[model samples]
Target: MSQTTLRRKFAAGLTALATAAGLVVGAPALVGAQATEQGSSASLGSAGSAGSAGSGDAPNTAPAFQPAAGNENPVGFRNWLRPGCSWDPVASWVQLCDVWSPAMNRHIKVQVQPARFGGNAGLYLLDGLRARDDWNAWTRDAQAQRIFLQDNITLVMPVGGQVSFYTDWDRPINLGGNLVEYKYETFLTAELPGYLQQHFGVRTDNNAIAGLSMGGSAAATLAARHRDQFKQVSVFSGYMNPTAPGMYTMIPLAMFDQCKCDPFAMWGLPGSPRWGQNDPLLNADKLRDIPMYITAGSAIPGRYDQPSSLQAVFNTFNGIILEGLSRGSTIAFQNTLNARPNQATFDYRTTGIHGWGYWNDDLIAARSAQILPVMNAQAW
Candidate 1:
């Protein structure tokens, strides 16, 4: 089918699905509007508990821990080492000491699944908007530990940042009646990398970043902003163009409804220069040299999903609306990128929703299709 015809059909399909799924409470408005009341907060709940087992049910294979001899530093001394290392028996990877971020003024946990061959190249996995404080969603919900067990690359997953967007916020947002200091861009791009390079043997030149939802946006923005550091990026169901027409308001409303956080504190008031600067579409030129893989579902429920309860049904409906928005935003971003000399591997799926099942699949697809090839080349 022609591109125009395909797009029209996709729109019609989405509208029909939304209406049937009980998403159309009133006259069909913008998907963003329907999404505001339901919001993406559905992700904050226990929707992933059913799928937390992940695709691989393999048992942990990490050997019993033994203390390193003589307190010898892995990559020599570092100043960011405020809170030191520990052993996590559950995942079987050495929990590298959670570092204190001067920017965020909090201790952020960083987990490392050490490369089998002691390879230095790192794959940074970023979490979504409703990031948990205990463990990254990749490990908890997606079983990433089992998936990359044999790979010769360090798996880096940072903990916390519920709605921070993994960016350097202009100011803190009051959420749950608490002010969250969200200098995540500085922590991840600057502070965390330096600490990882010194301690975990992660190399700046060979790292790839990927994220789901909020983290997906962060993966694109961070890679584009620091091309020298990240060589490849993958975004799964992320809103790539934050400065797009409805996004200016839709984003903040979602943030507030989901976490009581204010997006105004994230960048600035809508139409601020920071929004354009941080927008992946507006800064697509900076990502021209980097390999990127982007994917978003058409919001159709897939095989891996079954709504068993009323809450599950509501969650599924909300997910469909959210994924629809992501699909539209990703298409716009991809179209803009295609116009330039640079192009990303875009997987616009015919069926799926915004949840762990699709994000997990996208992660594996990105690894096989884009990340592993580059990392393998670099290894050779």
Candidate 2:
């Protein structure tokens, strides 16, 4: 039998899978290309809001869910480029913009997509600290596999803060001394979804969240908290246990050296909440219902494993070993999933690490049969 047929059979057999709008069990007529094909178009259109479309619960902007000409894929089908500007001006695939949250008391630079394949499914992507504002931050080789998402999902890359860990600092204020805190949680959950639909024409319900490294944990947390909003979630090399054994020491040191944050300033020393407040492990229950994908890899000694900026400093701490710590995320992730009976779907790979290569692979898997079924069913 063809791989697509297997996928269909397996998907059909997922009687335990979450409820979806459409499902063809046991070779239920394949629609798009498989992983090797890399380019396939899924059928989709506007769906009603699970909540309210473009309704601002906080300070937010909303986009539209309209599919346009030259883009047949709709939000979930096409993977086209959206133009965005940032610090000075440089042309790039991911459009970078700014978002201000009075609740957070900070101005955040966000990367937005006008529309990918004219589809309505939206994906909020996060970047690691050492990564630049220009790149998507997670899953670097997107240009190649973007075809998979073409007409399949809307890709939104948020230019993650330097060492922000995508967390809303527990402190009363932000790094720049802005008396207001960055309400990332609200922005991501409440505001951002509405904003995407109003501006880009994406249906809010037909969306999911995914990311790499630390961002992966953020994805888990969001999906868990708002499973009603997102149908699927994916994490590549995510931290399942923030307070994992030895992490309190190693993570702080790694942050100090690579992220350039005063350990005292960011986490307020070892016994502080700054470090552990947002670790997904602290709130594993929140992620129990969301379907997820996770992966990681270890570093090669003396080889360029991670981005130079991060790898250089982390290398001092037996970076290879630090890479090994990625297993911690995988372990914690497994522990939680296994504990629950069909809690959430997962794809965990022990062969990769906190780098772009692994992230790209995770993205592919998340977009594959494992995760896309949830996404496709999300269509109204």
Candidate 3:
């Protein structure tokens, strides 16, 4: 087929995939709306709970932690959307708030679904490798707003952290002649937390973090480094042992493929200590006593697989290989943690791949088994 025809076909396939998965909800939901402080009775399903003995069964009902009546949001915090800060409503109980990231020299968007009733507990959801600037995958693809609509924990989903691994890079990364600033570690751990606490009423220290794919490793690393900031952490298909044998070259190549960005700009060079420093496996010791939930699939086709079209087939193939690698690193990290009193939960699926569906499952499983229980946010 001609190149133009191929491009059109690929676009069509993407549209179909997005439509079938209901990823088009963000554009309409970005408008301003009002959210009532009420409790949610939403319950999780058993699908993500399948695998290990402690994978955590779905609770019969959501948590019942209510915030102080007049302290949900600061006075005049919901007046408008932009101009600095405000509670911009998205859905029944969701709001989009933007905060200034001094390091990045711009405003960063945070999609929030406040807990039913209100609570100081917050859950930060990180996005994958190709995270977009408009919205987070947790809310866009995984439908996190719907999933946690009734839960009593503020959902903090920060948008746009494409290939930086959500880390504080040594320097600015040049992506195809465009320099992109990545001070994510500082932004997430310090800047964002302060904003959430001051405006959203979420406690800076009372939080949990979860992520899929690339973001997964970031979640682990951040939680390990900033243990006081996070009570629990869950990694879905993350490459914990990033400094493992072939990864030195694999990461840079993947970065190049994604945006022609120089990986050296992230950590200096291959043998830089930052590489090992950022490796979740190397820093697993710091995660001790922190409620940990880690998961990776077998890479085989599973329920969410749809290899019907050319784009779908290509995606499935890529996902299988990626998940296979993630499984190896996940197992290695699990091994490092297993040497002690097993405080971590590992959910190794017999059949699955690296995709949003399985990551969504991992999120629900982590919440039920580890996150909520550890944060005292579950009603089980």
Candidate 4:
């Protein structure tokens, strides 16, 4: 069949699937590309509130920070730490904080949902290319707070990092009119974790990390490079192979077009060691023995989505192209790992798109099947 005919058939199939699944059809909203500019400084304010715990207790008004053991630094945590710029009380058990990131030289927000029953395991959720400064799309769009509220795990969702891929850049990039210094790798693996452990009772080791799209690739790279830090990792609709044919150009183009940021500042030139170091496919061997979950879709629009405008249709088309690239890269990474005895779960759907609906479902499934299991383990 011709390409157009195939797409129509796919859409019809999705419509049937939607009908069978009882999905509510809705106008297509921009999944991860809604935010146009970075966040500006503002005094912290309470955005919303939730119940105290997963069991529906009174909202907990207890202080979130305490001087726990090993928390005190000779330099003092107060020297650079600033908290409570923004708050989202998901429940009596869940709270989000905007903390100043000294490494990135700016304030970044993290959703802080304390683990139920005092569990020490933490889960970090990373966002995609057009990550907003106000909140991670996971919480704002994916209903992630509700998904993990009852679980015995701290949910860490850092806000903002548009087109950053969450990596430690060699130099600052001009984003729109502002020069952004992206040191997300350091903030996540070091500064943020230390803060969580000291103040929130989150454990540094045996943590779980997951991300979608740009964040997904970063999750894999970070988990592999910092194997001692993360016990489990998941990547949904991520570009795993950075050095694949046409990827060097394609990636830069995507980054530049999204936020007017130079991709070269991210990891040096295309053939540099940084690219190889960050490529999850090339570093697949480093992920051995770590429980991982990688998922992607064919980029076909699903039944729950409807293109209501020309911009929506264009955005949907763009998502298709980007997700198709990710699917191909993830499959290649999966095949490379087949050569070795590794523990990884691959979820490649024949139909779907790189939208919030699929990613939300993926997060729920990964948390239940892969993340929680490894986290609840008695030993690593």
Candidate 5:
């Protein structure tokens, strides 16, 4: 069939999918994306408020640092330390390493927790739309180091990539008086993985990837595109269909709100093949062999919500709408998977919103239920 015919069929299918998922078409979808970006900075601060035990309730009282065998530094892997990155240890297990990314032409900091008993499996955790340069939210918001301390697997979290969607863009972005290049797909799939294998004893192919919000979709995309490299994928509160009705516009608006970067530069114009190519729903067939853990909330306030405060109320409102949108897209993706022999686990929460607390819950659940087993890593 011709390209135009294929595009029309896809759009029609997307509209049907959205309607089936109970999503009001154009404007509401756009509003959800806008509100998500607007509230991300403030709402993100209330991470780990879920009131759940495993979901960030325990304190990070890991044992004192100890250097691995044959390594000199207190935290292990000193011998393999690259020049640009040094070991910045926070807890007994966590090490913040700054590694160079040639694609972006800058040094990127990665929060790492080496295996406690020396294992080869690794998990790459991704950040959200407003991802900061100094630290990955997985470390700042959630207690990843402590939670995974017993697991004989490395946790690799890369810092930064605000509004970049962790994808390789067609052009450079000028943000805050600096030109930033986003080749995150290249960095994560190729460059960073090489460094991890050499330095952290992680196999490039024996890995799992997880992310929340923007990073969630990115995790799925990266895993699908590089199936040989990533064995398992998990997405928490992610918009899986970028080419769905209103999402093509919604993604760019969110990008502009965060970095004033042009969305066109990231994936050409709306309806371009690149948009569909990057969409997880459109590429669902490619993931049939990969195990996936996908989740989203009802957008209702759960145990984590604090409605008394004004900022909290605003965040609650934004969280509801944002998660509702994420739910629509995620459910649509789930429906797509249902038709095929896809290996996916879907978690549709009865009460929750788009924030770190639920993502922490999802991550913990995924690790125990799917990730560890898929990568053949030991939980304890």
Candidate 6:
């Protein structure tokens, strides 16, 4: 990682969308491809239920709600894929969850769960900020989906929620040392690749990483930034533009606010001349070269008057969604996606909000051009 700042421009932080389970979708059919994995769960969960994407079960996550046993077309099927041993950590099966970017200072973390069935390559799954410690979702949903993977790829899930944007951070937070100062970028770009080759025997020709929400944004940004590293990248209803209008309302103002700095200071604010720098919107040209999977859901308004200790913030969230996220995130995502004028492989649709059910379900339906290549290359 280098201290050099990202000199590009970006919009406002895109508004976070409600999870897909709550949105309205007539139900889109699954894509043409079927990724092999042990458990079933092609499509399952509560319809029209509101929830947060990364905050709950997005990719590598289980349904917040389940159906009757007989109707377990999705849940039950995937459950079968779960290892019989209460040893549900997918990281244990084969390679399990392994932290990277430490030794060589690389910026990528890999979740390589040992496949009970044995495989190669890997599923580079990403997570939202809220999903840092939940191994169940990674073990079950990730491993289950691999039933389609014939063990040819590894499931690379990087832990370390808040700091990891899957990219090198220019500065350190609170007391942490600067990753760039420690050279994390070199590790993710160089050392980690060699580690995969040495440890997993992966060829690295086309290892893929697909993610939900913020993770999606990371996948796209990383692929675009380091094009040669990834053969493909996919994003599901991602909050693409960190600087989309009314988007950053949740960041330094809230989640990372106590840290004392933000992308604005890291780079520059809108109209500051450096705005839009490093933004996905500006890097669309770089992304146009890679196979991309992008999707979004129409977030709906929800109950706002509920009592809470942090009533003001809760009301803020309500106002943000109703007046901001309801429309702002979408505009940000679309604007960025549209940057690729001639997309050879891409997916951009809105059938629901940002929930696990629909996010997981969208994975089922958006596979025509998303992550199937990695799965297909190995076969479930």
Model 6 TM-score, all chains together: 0.60
What tens digits encode model 4's per-residue C-alpha lDDT throughout 187-237? Answer: 998888888887767888869999988889999999998987899999988
Candidate 3 residue lDDT tens string, 223-326 = 98998899999988888988987677567655544454666788878989999999998997888688889898886768777555433444454455567778
The TM-score obtained by model 1 is 0.79
> What is the TM-score of each predicted model, taking all chains together?
0.79, 0.64, 0.77, 0.76, 0.81, 0.60
Clashing pairs in 3: 40-150, 67-118
Candidate 4 scores a C-alpha RMSD against the true structure in Å of 11.0
The TM-score between candidate 5 and the true structure equals 0.81
Task: Rank the models by TM-score, top first.
Answer: 5, 1, 3, 4, 2, 6
lDDT of 2: 0.48
Count of clashing pairs, candidate 6: 68
Q: lDDT of all the models against the reference? A: 0.69, 0.48, 0.67, 0.67, 0.71, 0.43
Misplaced by over 4 Å in model 4 are: 1-86, 89-93, 377-380
* Most lDDT-accurate candidate: 5
Cα deviation at 114, candidate 5, in Å, is 0.7
Predicted model with the maximum TM-score = 5
Which lDDT value does model 5 have at 168?
Answer: 95
Stretches > 4 Å off in candidate 5: 1-89
lDDT, candidate 5, 14-122, per-residue tens:
3444455564545222222222222332221222222222332211111222222432233444334443555555453567777788998988888887775567889
Clashing pairs counted in every model: 0, 41, 2, 6, 0, 68
Ten contiguous residues minimizing lDDT sum, candidate 3: 36-45
Tens-digit lDDT track for model 6 on 1-380?
A: 11111110111122223222232222121111122211111111111111222222122233432212332122221222221122234422333334355543444334454322334454566665334334424334433344333333455665444423445444443424343323333555566566665555545554676776556666777777676677777776565566654444433342232122353343334444333544566667787666666665444422322223232223223322322232345355556656556453444333333344445655555444455564455233
Off by over 4 Å in 2: 1-94, 104-107, 114-117, 139-149, 172-181, 262-277, 298-319, 343-350, 377-380
The TM-score of candidate 2 is 0.64
What range of 10 consecutive residues in model 4 has the weakest lDDT sum?
Answer: 40-49
Error of 5 at 149 (Å): 0.7
